[model samples]
Target: MPSIQKPLTKRAWVRLPSGRRLNLLDPTPFDFEADDLALGAARTVRWGGHSVWEWPLSVAQHSLTVLAIGEAEAPRPLTAAQKLAFLLHDASECLGVCFDPISPLKPFLGEGYRQLDQALQTAVHRRFGLPADLPPAWKKPIKTADKRAAAAEAIFVAGWSLAECREALGIRAAPLSADPLTPIYGGLPWEPWPARIAAERFGAALAGLAGSMP
Candidate 1:
């Protein structure tokens, strides 16, 4: 008689740099750490590493840029939570597999991914002590700032023509002089920072913002 062979089970969890494991298949409550966020985000490249720069832009830089833009555009001083929200807008992207923007892929990937993304986003927000759903008043400005960063990224790093980027992203590139934050666009022509520096800067920014929270 032939013996029955045992089937192998696949591992569904991912271990982060900080030694914490996240189960991708099952949503569970896990403590969020700034170090893990910084490390993961620093290593995740934007534009799916399709940028024309010598080094691919990391999501860490993108997050920082968005925060800067939001800070500059706020009519009055922003709260600590609002600043943290901007800095963490892409924190879920640190998960690596779900980093792609959903707009272009939504039709093909359908609503499943969108739902998953939102779930992850809510978790991230909760981890940082923010409301599960961002208030619309804050959400709008952050999204606008994010789009402006996207337009700048498309033009400077991805090497897309202004018209092409504008049409694709549905956002007009703000004039470089329109805001102090706009200078980040000019710096895009330079090579991206190394992962270590990106991580450090992200961590530092988070610390600074947390200290300033009122």
Candidate 2:
């Protein structure tokens, strides 16, 4: 067998634990690995790491929060694909420096950022058998769930008050008073996990979801 050719040093690629290189500028469905996404998301800090707890909140934890809120409030159970979509919503951000830029900063960065994000999202969708354009039925629940999760994180994890999350953060919904994951994980509600635990849990979750897909 021939040896695999290495990517050029100048390309926008990051090496993963699986010994694969994901090219950010031109990512493909085949490039995503569960563990890579998990570890990357676990290291990515939300809200600039301004946390009340000793450890900062990771995107992996936030994704689970979004999933929990989405699932719990729905009239019926969300399908595995739908849940996976929620979990991987920000998977694109896991590609590089593990930095999750605040939503407010996107406007200043302009179109290129959005284009790249969309490209990666399309790849993620295809990799997991989701439609490139997600279902319209997903609109309301995901929007509401995502907002509530952000508000809860702001108040409980990031040292913000409900008033601040509303007036300043522009999150109109009332923050969740209780930890959504408490019944399942049994930790201090809304407290951030260490990166290693977050990564392992996220990896396992992704595997379970993928395995459940028909």
Relative to the true structure, how large is the alpha-carbon lDDT of every model?
Answer: 0.74, 0.85
TM-score of 1: 0.82
Best by lDDT: 2
Point to the candidate with the largest TM-score.
2
Residue range 1-214, candidate 2, lDDT tens digits: 9999987663588788788888888889898687888999999999898899999999999988888888889898889998888888888888654668899997877898888888887887898888887888886688788888888888888998778887898888878888888887888888899999999888888889988898
Per-residue lDDT over 47-79 for candidate 1, one digit per residue giving the tens place of the 0 to 100 score: 768777677888888888889888888999899
TM-score of each: 0.82, 0.92
Backbone clashes, each candidate: 0, 0
- Kindly give the stretch of ten consecutive residues in candidate 1 with the minimal lDDT sum: 175-184
Query: Model 2, which residues run further than 4 Å from truth?
Result: 1-10
Query: RMSD of candidate 1 to the true fold?
Result: 3.7
